[model samples]
Target: MTDEPRRRGAARTDELLRVTLETAAEVGYAGLNVEAVARRAGVGKHTIYRRWPTMAALLLDALSRVWTTDLDYHDTGDIRADLREQFLRSAPALAAPPIGPVYRAVIAEAQADEALRATLHDRFLRTVEESTLARIKRAQEAGELVSGVDLTFPAEVLCGTLYYRHLLSTRAVDETAVDALLDMFMAAYGT
Candidate 1:
């Protein structure tokens, strides 16, 4: 294919992914299907299947496009403040339309699907954790981080708490919650 056709193809794929996430958010992963996504994207089911080859693959693509996996870590030399800011930045993304519900659905699906679990771990979770660990190391080098804490520690504690609030409860993951979460972690690690 020529460059123009290839560019249009990529654009169509992007649209398909956007529609996939939105449909999954609205109807849930359980309810999401190729038919729905194709219909919403205004494309044929063959188009989606041709791109993904499997439902899991399609979901992984959609998530990769929309999931906010990284923090806006500016390294202001205060790990605590930076982490707080990161979580504050994450709050809106968590509560944002499509992302929140889609994440909740995927999380629920991953609990039951081994393929999803492996894919999420391999692709999203590991990538985000490694990036975060690298950021943590930078903070450590600056003598602003707690010694001996692991990288997954923040993911297990802070992100865990935030996700709990996001999916399980009606309580909002607001600024107060973000501050409280940051405080809890800072106290734990003495950061």
Candidate 2:
């Protein structure tokens, strides 16, 4: 039989993750209190501490739930169309206020916490890079990226453009920006 303590621990951890994310959504990272999470989860504060031991640990796990793994890469024969579709899929989450602030907070926290940084890098950031890179490489192989262009750079440009547009520009990242960015990337980089 499985160990009783380990099974209970796992259940408690899952409950905490649910409560933590819900609380994070209701209150931004600055207001994400451990006591609040414990109360929401219906678990004791010591139980949370016994599991995560730190707020950052709990926060990172909560952020991980933000990504929709169901929305993986879609490899249409047309690379530009595929990339556009991927961007469209991501846009809803980007459009969410809770997602934007939560992601920003997690990114800031990751910058300082080595362990959290690794978790974010491995779980979220790396997955995005890998998915995007796969699409870029497919585009290149299909002769969409011009022979002289640096494939990786175009992928970076795509992500960088959208991120900056959302994070800095006063203009909203609507369909116009998405279509424009895709057109620019495809025209300049497409073979």
**TM-score top scorer:** 1
User: What is each predicted model's overall lDDT from 0 to 1?
Assistant: 0.76, 0.74
After TM-score superposition, what is the CA distance of residue 19 in candidate 2 from its true location, in Å? 1.4
Worst 10 residues of 1 by lDDT: 1-10
Best by lDDT: 1
Which pairs clash in the backbone of model 1? none
Task: Estimate the overall C-alpha local distance difference test score of candidate 2.
Answer: 0.74
Cα lDDT for residue 81, candidate 1? 77
Candidate 2: give its CA RMSD in angstroms.
4.5
Model 2, span 1-191: residue lDDT tens: 54544436667677678778778878877788899997887667988888777888777776666565354678777887888788877876755755676776666666777987788778766667677877788777777676655566676778778767665566767778889998888777777
**Model 2, position 116: C-alpha lDDT score:** 75
lDDT of 1 by residue, 1-191 (tens): 34543334888888888888888878898999999998887668988888998776888788778766465476887877777777677777767766777877887888999988898778766665565667667876776767776756775666668778987889998888888877776676665
